[model samples]
Target: MSTENTGSLDTSLVAAAAGALAVMCASASFAGVLADAGWLIPALITVLAVVGVGVLGRRLGWPTVGVVAAQLAGLLVILTVLFASSSAILGVLPGPAAIAELARLLGGTGELIRTGVPPVPADPPLQALVCLGLGVVALLVDLIAVGIGTPAVTGLVLLCVFAIPASLADRMLPWWSFALGGAGYALLLAAAGHHRRWRRYEEPDRVAYALFGRTTAVVAGTAGVIAVLAGSVFTGVGTEGRLPGSVPEEFGGTDGIGLQPFTSLRGQLNRDRVVELFRVRGLQQDSYLRAMTLRKFDPRTGWQLDGLTQGVDANAPLPLPEGTTIGRGRPERIEVQPIGYRDPWLPVFGTPVSVSGMGRNWRYDPAAGIVFTQTNQETRPYTQQVIVPDPSPEELRAARGPMPIDPAYVDASGISPQVAELAQRLTADAPTEFDKAVAVNRFFTDPANGFRYDLTTAPSTGQDALSDFLFRGKRGFCEQYASSMAVLLRSLGIPSRVAIGFTAGYQDGTEQVITTEDAHAWVEAYFPGWGWQTFDPTPLSDGRTALPQFLDTALHPPQTPAPQPGQPRPGPVPGAPAPPVAGAQPDSRDVPQQRREPADRGWSITVLALIVLLACAGAATPLAIREIRRGQRLQAITEGREGAASTAWREVLDEVRDRGHQPRDTDTARQLADRLVTDHDLDATGADALKHLVTAVEREWYAPTAPSDGTLTDTLEAITRSLHHNAPLDLRSRLFPRSALPPWRTTP
Candidate 1:
């Protein structure tokens, strides 16, 4: 190729690269808006690919490897920019420590990958990788086709072949999808062949291509603008589908449990399952399936489970059964770990001694170890004491009595006879109600007995789910286990109910934040005399115990072993503090005391206002200094008899106004200068000098040329003297009469 052709090719490649870079940057910056505009990042990349091909064709360049590398680099740049900006892409990736500072400011570290803020909503990281891969492939095809002198029409056709699959891959696939999509796109592009359109050369006057390009640009710009406007409106409005408005009473209130109006039926069923699981365990203790408690149940809507009522007299006593032992022994420290949705209901093992730091509406249900809150809010983890009656083994073994079923519990007479028969058969060979309960608990808890834990939603076979679980699919989660237990126990004349809470799992260093994933269902049954008891028959065989796995790894990280077995352990480094063992409690003496200063309204306000004023002044200092430096530079240039002499003169006119000289809006620069000189008592020489400065400034401003340094120096000196002599006693004070001044400023 000729040198001219090579130069053209190089320019075209540069232009293409620049265009691709611009598009990538734009997409990254406004990803959310682009999503709203239906202009996905993948689509933007395809457009960039098209632009690249066009540039390649015009410049007559053909370097596939270079194009692919350029595209990849562009993608990396886009990711970096988006990550820096705290856009969705940043949330998707797990960044290195170097980006931690940036991540902190952007609030990007916690967000889920591929999703925007509220990290849980984003697509997985694997999906993002796929989209990036597709982008690279698309660019490669563009480079190859364009370099071969493929006609613009032919290339345009080939571009679409690659674009569609890339879009789908980005939308559907995780990391692997990108490769698959890229392969498909490449195949399509290759199939389009090297057909070149002769029409452009045959009809050089054709305006179709130009019109198409302009139309595309206009459409893209318009869509972008609309997307921005729509996003602004949505953000202003805020999220529409939020959770329940009120808190649950179990958080800290005397109110009964109430459900949110729109509580999903699926959630209710899940909760019911948990209650059944407890029943199957046959513990016969009043266990709380703590959820949101409602005090002020709206008669119309039923119950608005708000948060715990503020300021309930928690010191008051909870009603307990007569003859019930109070403080019979030291309270058992039950550490509850709620693993699922951060609901407001606080869970405990038994009757609580006292709930500390609970909301006002919340109250401890001493009879049943549970904390009640008035409202249902997000879930959180807490520790509370439970007065668990640990009866002796002899007492438990000798216990024999009728199961104290709740009066409200319906008997099997209400159900089909077969159900009752099935329950009898399940409880056969048990001598007492307690034995039967034990039998039920063992059957469900025994994983070898066909019980299986699954996360998939089980299909509803019929109303008698217990029968189905016992005979059909043994695979089910906590809900199925609990439900089956409850139904069978109730059938056998034992009063039972379901309890829903989270299983203790991951210890979040200090305490685990109960995620929604840990939702569990169990059974609670009432034993005569002993009161209500808790039982959980859900098989614990699964890796649910993996919570300690994280803890173990964190606490016992692998370290280099000492060469000699009897050698003393290494001591602390010269300055650094010794590292604490995993789960070791900090020394009480080392704990820092937080001292709070007494509130002083007047002093606080005054201090705050003064600080704010100082901050403003500090921020403005740089701008003030910049202005002063510019003025000095102008003065010096004028004095040197260089360019900008006239500009320096005009600046002097502005200085006159700054010294409290009121000039008419339409006043000429000369008029303003003359007024300043006359009103400020400037000498005739100074006054004339001011007028000459104005003329020079106006001339330089309108036409522009090198300013004479001498002229600039003269104008600066004249303006400085005039302004200092006529300095305002507070510029605003001179501008307005005392009576017209604001009252506050007048006093100061």
Candidate 2:
């Protein structure tokens, strides 16, 4: 083969790897999205399918369009069923109804994309949309960059994917995402543009090839830096890119989750780390600062807001509280400063009157009574002038109006009947609605009602979550207490919404440092004249996190990992802390509860070691079988009594099978010679060699006596070459010989 032809063989492999890297680059954006882990499997399948089909297409002589079309069809069928089918009604794959359901889930995407806040506790609709979106992107990158042989075009497609997510989110994208995307595009350009040295020409194009390589690297490197920098800068991977991409060690970086807020699903209310998110000054009393209020409740999906949101400019006069007599009411000028946490919303005391010395990204909604920023909003220090009202018990009782609260609060369409009944039983004594609300809040959080605060509890979703929290072992942190209180109050005709924000931090002189541990939620009951008042039904203190007296025998999320009477549960725990069972928790310091002993250490280790040895032996089995067969042929030569005949004949049969032909095991020495000579167009020398071997074996077996053989090694070697020359160079025939494998295991 020509030198150029040898290089072309290498080019194809490099191109295939480049194509996979391109898909990975685009899929890297998924890391910031909520369902990132779920997207990885589908993304991998897409890349592998593209490369696999491309290889097969080359062998089958298919065009580029055909290969692209085949890969697209396969990926669509796979991803649609994997992601969309399970979520569909009745679990049918590729139905119109399922497609419609997927569309319905994706309907509010524009708003979600615009908000750019990652909705944790994964929205099923959003998961489906992301799965399909990335699949299509992978196909486009594969076809345009790899199939069309212009890898430079892939940079544009990747840029669009990176820019949209980065513009919306302030969180930094991981550095590797940019690096991989760049490397893939550069490799593709090199493979397609200059690596095809196999095509022979009158003159070599060394200068042109060298120039193209240099150009591709410079362009690819530039694109990579831009894409990665955009995400990292937003993520507090800061502009300098010096901050480590991973969670720091002090913050339980063991599992990759750094300190985040209560905004995430089942918040990691850090049990240890003290990394301050921000600092606040002014309010001496415990300040409940609101970030994003989750008001709109859906039965199928839990807390989400789909209401009308109107935006006002940053410095614009925020609309005063409706029907408010509570103006500048306990006015507190709060000075806030950010440490490392980057948030779009500047945590401020709500019913925020005004903000100064901030960027233009901030916007306010009169309806929600909250101020948020969009553009330069990641943790900018701002001094907010807020009106904090503390209406007394007497004033709150008398506070009444036309009920300007949204009708959704009073609808109570999906509140659990158990919760409603419980509310009725709890509030039967209270004469007024305001008093009844207070009674309900106290009843739920009262330690006498068997509730305690534990950050490790698993939260439930949907309409009946209140029922689970109340009836199924009432032991959760602040979210359960707050959410249940709001639902129960709503059931009793009280207007309420769940407020998400941080609790008062540990004070340092005038300044208060708020850590991730302080993130909390509380219920706000809307009163006509007094406005929305925050209530804490959560018994944060004075109660051990252990479950109630009544629920000792009951099974809850926290207790799921403990071994039952007839069961032995193994493996590290799921998303809950160590269960208070089987000595998992210490029973006093001295002579603590003994852990259950595991089975048979010596026997298990021995068995495992044997299994590993057997597996290694199995891998080398082909080489072993080849050597054994060769030794048997050697025994037939020099040492054996009869035969130049048996040695020569066995060599010919072994060569034919090794070179990609499977002949009958029963064929005699002479019969094998007849077939090999005719089927393979062997020369006269090869035919003569085969004839002499067959005659010798026949004479040794059937004649009166065995003949001492003349040199038959040359004859056997000639026949072997003829067989090897005609055999196809497919992977299986050369490396994986039929002789190395058993007769029944051979493929046609």
The clash numbers for all candidates, in the given order, read: 97, 5
- lDDT per residue for candidate 1 within 25-79, as digits (tens), equals 3333223212242335544645564555455444445365554555555555444
- Write the residue-wise lDDT of candidate 2 on 1-748 in tens digits: 5665543334444556666666676667656545347656655775676566665675577898887777776665555566567665466455776666556767866444422344232455555565566656666766654455444455556655654444334455557777777666566655543323222221235323533455556646765765665454334321111121122222221111111113321222232334466788887455677765656655433444334355576476666655455663677788888664555555668567888766666677665665665443345688888877755555666777687656866667876677688788776766666677777666654444555565444355432555655765465666667777777788888887776677777779888887665667777777786667677667665321222111211112234456788986775322112112221222111221212122212343335334543553564356345544554554355344456567667666767776656777677776767888777777787788778777777777788376556556545656664564554334444324567787654442
Error of 2 at 496 (Å): 0.3
Best by lDDT: 2
User: In model 1, where do residues sit more than 4 Å from their true spots?
Assistant: 1-330, 333-341, 364-370, 376-383, 397-406, 409-414, 456-463, 506-517, 543-748
Task: After the best TM-score superposition of candidate 2, give how far the Cα of residue 479 lies from its true spot, in angstroms.
Answer: 1.2
Model 1 / residue 601 / CA error / Å? 47
Q: Given candidate 1, what's the lDDT at residue 489?
A: 77
Local distance difference test, candidate 1: 0.41
Q: At residue 279, what lDDT does model 1 achieve?
A: 12
lDDT of each: 0.41, 0.57
State TM-scores per candidate.
Answer: 0.36, 0.44
Clashing pairs in 2: 4-198, 171-235, 172-231, 172-235, 173-231
